[model samples]
Target chain A: MRELAKMVIVLTVLSSLSGGLLAMLREKTQDRIEQQVLEFVKGPAIRKILAGAANDPIADRFTLADGEAKRSFFVGKYDGKPDVVAFETFAGGYGGDVGLIVAVAVDTDQIVGVGVTTHNETPGVGAAVETDVGFIRQFTGLDIASGPKVTKDGGSINAISGATITSRAVCAAVGKAGDLYKRLKPEILKQLKTFSG
Target chain B: MAKTVTQEFVKGLWAEIPPFRLVLGLCPTLAVTKTVEDGIGMGVATGFVLVCSNLLISMLRNVIPSKVRIACYIIVVATFVTVVELLMQAFTYPLYLSLGIFIPLIVVNCIVLGRAEAFASKNKILPSIADGLGIGIGYTLSLAALGAVREVFGSGTFLGNPVFGPSFQPFTFMVQAPGAFVCLGLMLCLMNLAGKK
Candidate 1:
């Protein structure tokens, strides 16, 4: 009984100590990690998606609260006005959660571009979705309020050859982003004023 | 029978080196030595975890119940690995991306648990630090040496720069998995030959 108590106490104490240290370290590194993500992961994707924008989209960003979570929005100015906004959304994919960044023309509520930010999909098959230019371009100019779907699901978009699941994941992420955008459109527009060049 | 702190430190560089002499922690040793940059990055990250965990484990050795020592050591090692991952993601995003899944896998690397169990658990704090530092540096040196050989022969470049003239042809086999095995074997043989005297 004494040995059992000692074991339990030691394990409990060690786990909690480990947990506490991690939690504190996470809190301290959260902002810097977020910044690094912007500079590395999101930066290239956003720059490519929001191409030709007069202002740097990555440097012009803001966050708005939706419910329990805060979502960041990157602003792109074209012809000296903050006309476009971009954000990330996720959905289940072939390997795990697939992250897709969807950019929208705020005035018309039309998708300007779509890009994959992170994924664990199969290398040559599902991963081809990133470089599959024609498929990605189809998302552009689509109505942001209307949920987009692949052709098999009775939508205009065609799925990538041999990667229907990953294609569907991207569609699903855009659909979820549509719902999020509709809910937060008012707050997003209000925040965009400050970023306008 | 008493060994000084200097001896403990020196042994890690050659005698009891984690990967070569101890023949431990071969996974990262095999996977990340494709480039000198990547090899050094993996080594530094592993060394940091090994040292931090060793220090904390030695400090807590007296208080931890022997029955739950392994569990306690894991908690400590895992916590430090996570801390390293978070910091890398924040400050060295490129290295973090290049190293990928291996950063989190450091928790399972036996060198850490081996040191905690064999050395830190019974030794004083200073010697434990020495052992961790020595083994860590030795591991780093071994990996860098292998990385240099592979990079120079495989790609005809050293650290991404052309080491040979432009006319030189790269031995592509040196960068592949089979090459890693052959290189490691030959290096191991050489080490054995040196130690035989």
Candidate 2:
């Protein structure tokens, strides 16, 4: 009984110490991590899709409460006018989840451009989404209401060679983004006004 | 005593290297070696956790009851892993994203637990630190080497830059899942042949 008590006490103390240390570290690094996620992971894609914007889209971003989830939208301004918003959506792909950033011109309700933000898809195949800009560039000026699809599905966007599954996955993500844009259009517009000059 | 410490550190380099010799921690070995960048990043993170956990485990070895020792080691390992994860996400988000899921998975990394059970639980603080450093660095080097070979053959690029001209068609197969196994096997065979001499 004494031995068992000692073991239990030791385990409890060690666990408590571990938990306290981790909690403190998390608190210290929380903001810096969020900033890094904004600058590195999501920044390049937003900058690429919204290239002509006068302001830094990553810095001028906001989130909206959608049911239980908070959705972040990067605000892009062109000629000092806040007119574009880009956000991420995910789709199941060949290897894993493929992340796509869909940008829309708020005034035009048209996709400014679509960019690949994150993916674990097969390298040299599905990974072309990041390597091959032309594949993503096709989404520019696409009508969101039309619902973008691959050329095989009677849409204008061409599927990456030998990576049709990934291409379709990206299309699915874009389609989801379009739906989200429609659902959150009013909230997005209101958020954009706050960023506008 | 000094000789033993040196021995512990050096053994991890060639005699009992993870994935190569010990055949330990093969998951991260295969998963992160796609790029030299990711390989080094994971190796260093694993090393940090290993070193910190080993040091703490050694320090608390006597105080921790033998029956509950495993639980204490796990809590220690887990705490360090969380610290690494949060720090990486804060300072290096791109690397963090690429190494996603794997960071948290380090808690279960056999290397960390293996070292704690095999060496740290019985050793002094200085020796534990040495052991961790050796094993961690060895793991890092192996990943970096595998990453270099795979990236060169698979993509004809060295760290995302075109090492070969535009006409150089990449092997493409070298970066896939089977490619990782095949590459590691071939490298192991070479290591074995060299060891024989």
Candidate 3:
């Protein structure tokens, strides 16, 4: 009984010490970690997409909404019009989750740009979605009417070589994002008008 | 005392290699070893945490009760992992982003807890520190070797730079999940061959 009591006391003390240390460390770094994650996800990609607009609204000020299974993005204003309203779409690829941040020009319903956010595909093959500028660059200025299909399938955009699965996945994700954009456009436009007024 | 410490430190390199021999921490070993750089980053981060946790755990071993020792060790290991995570995020954001969830998952890595129970709990502080260093080096070398094999063939690059000449047609599949297994198996075969000598 004495040995068990001693053991319990020792364990309790050690647990408290370790927990206290971790809590202190977490308090110190939580803010910085949140800031870094935000910057990493929204840095250069968002800026590049919004560059063509006449007015540049703060990307940081944008609000994010999670719908049933989609992510809705609302950009405040660009010049006299809503800059771009977007929905990020995700799909499973050969490696893992492939996410695309897609924005459509509010005026023309054209794709502003598509950014490959998360991917774990094979390097030089599916991973080319990030390194191959041509694949991503084609998304810019493309309207929903163009049909988001690979060139081999009789569409305008070419699929990445040796990474057809990942390419197809991205293409499919962008197509879904476009569909969501069209569905959300009316409500987004109303919200934009209210904000502008 | 010095001899025992040396033995504990050196044992990890051969007798108890974390991934290849012991088959512990296979998740990060396979997941982050797409490139030599990422492997090295993970290895070093894990090494730092291991060393710190081992030292602390060994020092507190006498004070921790046997029944709850495992729980106490986990708390210590997790605290060190959080510190390493925060430090990497602040100083090495790119590497941290590349490592992603695997960094936090280190808290549950069998190798860390394995050493905490097997060696640190019964050993003196100096010897436990030595054991940590040895195991950490072994883990790092294995990851780097794996990463090197994958990056060279899979991408025709080493550490994100083109190492192979332009004429080299890279085998894209070598960097994928299947490739991880292939490379690891080949490495084990080679290690076995070396052991025979």
> DockQ, per-model, please?
0.78, 0.73, 0.37
For residues A57-141, what per-residue lDDT tens digits would candidate 2 score against the true structure?
8889999987898999999888899988999999998988888888989888888988887788888888899978788878788
Misplaced by over 4 Å in model 2 are A89-99, A118-187, B1-4, B14-21, B157-197
Quality of candidate 1's docking, in CAPRI categories?
medium
In model 2, the clashing pairs are: none
User: How high is the TM-score of chain A in model 1?
Assistant: 0.86
Q: Interface RMSDs of all predictions? A: 1.0, 0.8, 2.2
Best by DockQ: 1
The fnat of each candidate, in order, is: 0.93, 0.98, 0.57
As for DockQ, the candidate ahead, 1 or 2, is 1
- Chain B fold agreement for model 1, TM-score: 0.98
How good is the docking of model 3, by CAPRI class? acceptable
Which residue window of length 10 is worst by lDDT in model 3 chain B?
Answer: B1-10
Candidate 3's C-alpha runs over 4 A off are A52-197, B1-7, B14-16, B20-23
- lDDT at B142 for candidate 3? 89
Model 3 lDDT per residue over A30-143, tens place: 767755654576545555666665554334233434376434364635665665765457878889879877777778888878878778898767888876888888888888
- Write candidate 1's Cα lDDT for B72-110 as tens digits: 898899999999999999999998998999999999999
Clashes of 3: 0
For each candidate, what TM-score against the reference? 0.86, 0.81, 0.67
